[model samples]
Target: MIVGIDLGTTNSLVAVWRDEAPQLVPNVLGSVLTPSVVGLDDQGQVLVGQAARERLQTHPQLTAALFKRHMGSAQEIALGKRKFRPEELSALVLRSLKEDVERAFGEPVEEAVISVPAYFSDAQRKATRIAGELAGLKVEKLVNEPTAAALAYGVHQKDKETSFLVFDLGGGTFDVSILELFEGVMEVRASAGDNFLGGEDFDTALIQHFVSSQRQDKHFPDVNVPGMRNRLRCEAERVRHALGQQPTATFSLAQGGRQWELAISQDDLQHVSASLLERLRGPVERALRDARIRVADLNEVLLVGGTTRMPLIRKLATTLFGRFPAMHINPDEVVALGAAVQAALKQRAAALEEVVLTDVCPYTLGIETVEQFGRVLESGHYLPIIERNCVVPVSRVKTIQTLHDNQTHVLVKVFQGESRLVKDNIALGELSIPVPARPAGEVELDVRFTYDNNGILEAEVKVPASGEMHHLVIENNPGVLAPQEVRQRLAALAQLKVHPRDQMVNTTLVARLERLYQEHLGEVREMLGNMAGSFQQALASQDVECIAQMRESIAHRLDELERSPWQ
Candidate 1:
């Protein structure tokens, strides 16, 4: 089986290739969406998905959902005496996905091409690939989510010259990808996104709205209270959904010995959400700016995600681009569908010939030069030599003269970002090029950057005078692991004993939990069943609650089940 996983920050989903069709694997609950959350059981067992998410709502400090945002950071979250890197935690999610897909197909599936946001950094991208390895999956390819969505949407349109912008508002990340479809080839010109923004922002906006409503309308104290944050978030999401169509919607919460209700207007929501919307403007503008296509030139705008259902988003996108976005596939499924389509193509050679795609580096990639001047001489500058929207299978060369006299070695620090300062950009790696000892401006150096179909950046610094050249690859990044270290670690990882304690307990635990929730579905409904039924179903079926309904239901039951092991 070939699988496609959208390893999102807030949610993780698994899709499989079956008989030429990409089918989403429904969890035990018979649903597709899974919450990317995990918690620990009383017996030091790992819990994943919905149950894990529920633990976050009831036990906020213990469970984590948006760890994907912390991928490149030096942070750690400990659970049950085990310290986990973000990559490890993410690996567990992928492991669970692998397990569920195997159960659905009753076949072994090893290779997968997971999707990532277009704006992921080199460190982040490497970390993501590592997470895949830890989960025991061979990453066939890593495709950007927005570009995947473009493939799905582009195929439906017969217009040979259509250009579109894919506005993807996911659970924890937001991306805008501009693509042009020509002669069955979908080429991505520019992609931009905010890893920190998404449906969560709207939740924050709703929180602020409620905070004000409490202060003025109901005259309650500040909105902070035990369990109140979760209630506020839930109601905020509710109000956001309802206000999308209705002029107003009611939001009510019970906390601190009181029940508060709010009838929020759409205008109020748009106002409260203005700050969040303002943040999106930069990404949108940057994507279009890089694509070099005017909003007026775009034939259509493709909207992806449940959040795009918001009236403000459609309004803003239409206002900015002069065209209302099109939603051919379910916004929630467009990216996943695109992923499935790609996975299918990968399995069959015949399909590969029919499908051709071009994707670009979502952010600017540069190298730090001498001094604190942060000169990005290669592919990063005021005007990139290759240009953002240029056709791919392309190489661009930058010429730099020797800065100092008798400089034999030049240190080039490659970075990635749109920031104007060195401190603001991501330092990808460094390269040292040897030149014939010469005076200032005597030697000519050519820095060639070649980006291929996979979005992999290969750079070589050449000294024409001395005929010396040095090259750098993502894995060859200094101080990370010098190839030899990785081999040693993998050798070490083989003997590390990752607690493969047989599924005797895992199976029993899974079956018992499934049986309990299957019998009394309300345990999930009232607890997490508050969300859509299909979403909740996925939660109830996992060793971890991977959905809201599943999280709440499983966490509640687990709590009750924990109080009496003898029962």
Candidate 2:
């Protein structure tokens, strides 16, 4: 079965279209929300999801989270003794989700439709595809998260006609998309976003506040300790989530032989996060301006993503459009459901037979050229062949003459972005085509760019005079992994030992206990350590009922301890 995956920065989920509707697949833990974290246990076994997330507070050196923010970069994170790329970390999460799908369907699955941010550049998109390949899944399509949300929303309103704006602010990215729906057709008019802005940044803001406050009192925590930042981050998230529901929450951390707490209110969060809020405005305004639709003309505004659960974000949306946005769909699961819809559409499912979809290229794509200013020529100018937000499966062409006399060949450097200069844009690839060496303007070249719904771009250069043509699909992009590198990564991934699926419950419990143990001191720390030992001894007994009973008993105690307010 072809599954739909929302490989998000903070969490990931898998869904499939079945029985004329989309259904989320539950993981082994019987939960649809799987934390996007990966780690190595003390025994060097691979751990993912909740287990990995728990270890972030105890075995921070052996775990990695939030790698999604560095998707297309060359940076490598150390997970224990091994170093892994962001794509590699992402693949681990995908592999875990793949196993979840197989367990749910009782069959082997190999193909998937994955969702990504709308404004992801070519490098980021390519990196996402490579992550799928590394996870042993054939990526059928990379659907933009906002577009996928619209597709899922459109599935419910296929018979109606309307225009809407999708505001998607997730764990680590923000996207705004303007769309129109009519007669079972969903068209994305424009897409824009900041890949670096989201809920994670809010956590960082809280962290900074706590740190700055501590500094004023001449008290400093040894943040250089491997797990200190993780502890602070956990508190920050707790405070952020608490503030979402209540007017105030305390950010508390135990460090430097004392308990540090700062009471933060909703207004304080908004004040400290002002810059991020401003960043959100730019993308929304740009998308509206690109779509040429006014706020008054939009029939509805839809909010998608877990970050939108914050009242601050909702308030911002309300103030922007002068209307309360719609949230009929579950923000967290909407993208995965939409991906399942896309998967069904790919198979031409009968329920979606009348549905048609069109998406835009989220960024401008073109070739670098020289602009003539009277007798002087200035290079580095960007000539757009396909402007941003143009509907895809689109092809656009531009013609240009050579700049110098006897130019033997014209080098076409392709780029993507809205900057006027190529220097400010992202270089995708370059192609050199031979000319007849005719004087300056005598040689004319035709450049064509074709963008598809899946966000792949193809560039073709044709020398009409010499009948010479060259085509490029941008495989040499610096951000993409080489074929050999992919093979080597595959080999390396194969060598890692994955923790047995049947023992996940015990693994997760142990990780949780370890984290709790690290958070307390004296009597509480001793109690947690003793509890962990008892659980480990129960597992060693090899008695199913004994282990099950002990697990329930210890889990209850942990829950009680967790529910208590921090010191």
Clashes of each: 18, 0
User: lDDT for each of the candidates?
Assistant: 0.69, 0.91
Q: List where candidate 2 sits over 4 angstroms from the true fold.
A: 473-476
Error in Å for residue 389 of model 1: 3.4
How many clashes (backbone atoms < 3 Å, residues ≥3 apart in a chain or on different chains) does model 2 have? 0
Tens digits of per-residue lDDT for model 2 on 1-567?
788999999999999999999999988888899999999999999999999999998889999999988887788999878999999999999999999988877999899999999988877888899999999999999999999999888898989999989999999999999999999889999999999998999999999987888886656677667788888888888888888889998887765567777889999999999999999999999999999999999999999999999999999999999999999999999999999999999888999999998999999999898888998889999999999999998999999998789989788899999999999998988887888987889989989999887798888988999998889756566577888999999999989999988999889999899888877877888999999999999989999999999999999999998777764
Q: How well does each candidate superpose onto the true structure, as a TM-score? A: 0.78, 0.97
Pairs with steric clashes in candidate 2: none
Question: Residue 566 in model 2: shift from native, Å?
Answer: 1.6
